[model samples]
Target: MTKADFVRRCRWLIACAVLFASANAWADEKSELKEKALKLNSITGKDPIDGKIKELAKDAENTKKMLKVAAEVAKEKPQPFQYNGAFILARAARELKENEIALEFFNISTQLAMKVKSASKLLESFDGKISLLYEQKKFDEAEKACQELLDLEIDPKFEEAKIIVLEQMIQFKAKQGKIEEALKLTDNLMKLDEGGWYFVRLKGWVLHEAGKYKESAETYLDTIKKLSENKRLKEEEKERWIERTRYILSSVYVDMGQIDQAAEQLQMLLKKKPDHPTYNNDLGYIWADRNMNLDESEKLIRKALEEDRKQRKKEGVEKDKDNAAYLDSLGWVLFKKKQYAEAKKYLLDAVKDEDGQHIEILDHLADVHMALGEKKEAIAVWKKALDTEPASKRDLKRLEEVQKKLKAAEGK
Candidate 1:
């Protein structure tokens, strides 16, 4: 109520107003920058972040515009926009092959995300960083980054991140031919996420990749059992899992030359899902390959090809021709039955189709040519098969066989 008291109070109110106005101005500026950044991010397609940059890079002026806006937003240093902007810049630099700049911004973004206690952003940034490092073939740095990610505080909600990091570690180790070390990490992941069927399957996949066929088969069987008991999956889901695992199991059995075991697995799968084209073709092919039950194998293969055509039609896809794999299976079974002319027709379609020309399919085509005494055609088909890149153990074996065949043909 006194004069001096009122003046002092008015001064304090003025100071408070100034501070509030300053805060509002700062917020307004931050919001504007965020809007600009969001707009830019949206226009950059959902392809790989670097893909956006590569496409954008095709137009230098637009790239310059986005780069400027992103840099300005990054300078804002607000809680989240700063980190988001840094990510954009990093992607752009990465695509531009400015490796040092990209790496620097990636580090900044991840560290900023951590400072804000955002677990999801941190994980995402870690993924981006590791992916960039991997793309650059800097395995050693990526390995170290994986270690750093593992060392972080993993809240239970984000505990899954630990497995992701381990997977990356296993991948690089596997790439470097450290199969034993990769196996150990996969084991660690299996133990950590044993409750999940996917992890158990991962272990079997690693073993299979390492050519441990017997162990892969055993592990897949174990996962099938574990998945069966999981109670989380209803009967239908469990049946689906069993059918798929058994399909994989059959492959390992075949690889180990346990032909009977493989046939049994495929038979079980067919019993459960009679219309599954893959299982039907696999069983038919296995039987024919082993020179057993040729008539039944041909029937199974026909049924598979028919089912596949029906499925494709239902899906609104054109099935004017047979599926390449199914055709190949039918061709093989007919070859086994010494019906070479009929087999040749199907095998020729397979070799000339878009989804066909698979090395094994080509090999089968070549074999059919040889059966028909078309030596020139056989040599040409075998040469084509040899030019195909072998992607698996089976394909590699076919390649080796083709190499021998080529040598024999040359000598003759």
Candidate 2:
């Protein structure tokens, strides 16, 4: 061989040897990283793994460093290591609340997870995506993700996750004011567990909101009966269910204008827990508004206020800044007793604190003002109240009376 050709061959040999050594070193480094990750996974509860994950996520400089390392490693190995690295990065991103980065990582994880047939990992990724979409109020995307989960054919072991997604879909439909769609979805949930109290309660709430009070009351009654028979539940839980059922039934009766029936239900509730302020307030306010049993209404309302104060003091809880309903009840009761000054004070307090412009409170305040001969203020409050009154015959009649009073006050 010629000297020139031999020299060229020697150089080529050296280059190839250097390349092989570098590749071997890179492989060793990657193997070491994998071992370290396994060690991390082996650590027990209260370890620094979660902290390490969080720290890595917040270190944007380190994330770029790791991503570059991942790209290089992926170029060299191009298999399982790439998937593992991507998943680790995704977890870190999620911990940092960098959802866009997390989503990108999740998409890569989904592809890798599917390739490995890692059902749990895939489900986790899908769940993260669905939750992100839901938080963003992207209901269409959230629904799509939910559908993807259902399509995955995940085992019954993940039943709770599946049910959560189903419930989310139902809630989304309900929020969109699609009551019929929500009801249909609820029926599907019921079919999943024929006698599920949770589903029954959900159906009752939806029906009540949709103005199907009779059906709602029946559903609530059935739920109460079923829950009562379930000896497996604790006493506290059973009591909660009973209270919920009675509360719904009472509300339905009130809506139907069956005040006597509502009063009866409230009486039963009070018998169970005589200090239930809501029940006391509602029942007393109903009677006071109708100008019936003025003395008893006053007693009940005062009892409610006393109960609330006692409970707050016992629990070391802060009192609400605005007790508008309680004040309104007190004011109306005092008005019935012809104590105009005392009634005006409480009603005005309610009107001032109720920043949401509560029509009922405004009406009561106007009535008190009229009694106190504050003609201008009474006319203003009455006009404001009338503006918000529902378009019903009874409300229209009240509006007419207010207008007549306003005209008389104006000397028209």
Candidate 3:
């Protein structure tokens, strides 16, 4: 061979040797990572919370390594371990806010769990996948996942999970403007539940969400009537059901612009359980929102805050922070009463609380800022309200209103 040909042959051999060495190094690393993952025993056990997975998720480098090994194991391992690896990867991905990866692995976990015929693992995987899909507003995929969950070979012990899935499916359909389909799902749920009153109440909720206020109110009344006649339910349970339905009926009345009817339902509930925080807050907020009974609304709101604090103490919550919703009620009532300064104070605190970090509450705060002539603050708050994730159809509507408000304020 010529000298140049000999040199070319040697270079080709050297290139092949380097590639082979690099492949070996990757194999070694993959083996080490797989071993480390399998050693996270808690992930594959009855308790799936693994300190190692959580610890690994806390660091970017470790998270990358964990995901790499987990993907390989999920793809190549056998049934149970495959599910375990996928589940671990999903959990870690969720922790790191890698939602798309989490959704993918959760789906893989669900498929593997089905192969292993593990009901609990399947449910967990489905839950993770469905919630991620829902949060991402991938409604079509969420609808499909919900149906798949209902089609699972659900264990008797997991019947409640099935019911919960049905409820989510109904809500999904309702939000998509598929009112008839949503009602049909509710009917199916009622059949599965043997015509339980709660299902009837759920039907009422579906109707209410679909803007069928009259039908919704009637269904709620039907639910209450059924509750009263059910000999199987204890008196206290029946009463509780009736009270909740009444509260729900009140909202239906409010939607129909039947303020008097709404107030009557709440009044009935308050007569029986005077200190019920929710009842007080709802009635007070409704009256305040309508700019009627401002004095009485403020009183009821204050009572709600007080009663809510007492209830939290009774429940042994370590922190005794005031309920954010109740605080919003108070702030809104004060705003209606033209006490903008005090209203802003309560609203600022309300917005700081986790539960109060809602578009509606933010709008209320923004309104207060506008009332107090803080135009810049109001615009900022309205922008923030728009930025907050809308959790429901109502929030979406509120966001539209906020957009309008921002446009008007900016124009001014």
- What TM-score fits each model? 0.65, 0.57, 0.74
Higher-lDDT candidate of 1 and 2: 1
lDDT of 2 at 368: 86
RMSD of each: 16.5, 15.4, 7.0
| Model 2: CA > 4 A from native | 1-165, 168-172, 318-322, 354-356, 383-412
Ranking by TM-score: 3, 1, 2
lDDT of 3: 0.84
Clash tally, candidates in order: 0, 0, 0
Over 4 Å off, model 1: 1-165, 168-172, 193-198, 318-321
Best by TM-score: 3
Q: Which ranking of candidates, highest lDDT first?
A: 3, 1, 2
Residue range 48-98, candidate 2, lDDT tens digits: 545666567667665544544543444444443534546665677666556
Give the higher-TM-score candidate: 1 or 3. Answer: 3
Tens-digit per-residue lDDT, 23-117, candidate 1: 99977766664565555434433465556555655655655555555555555545334665577767776666666667777887789777787
How much lDDT does candidate 2 score?
0.73
Q: Candidate 3 lDDT, tens digit per residue, 168-241?
A: 88877886788899898788878877857888998999898888899999999999888988989989888988
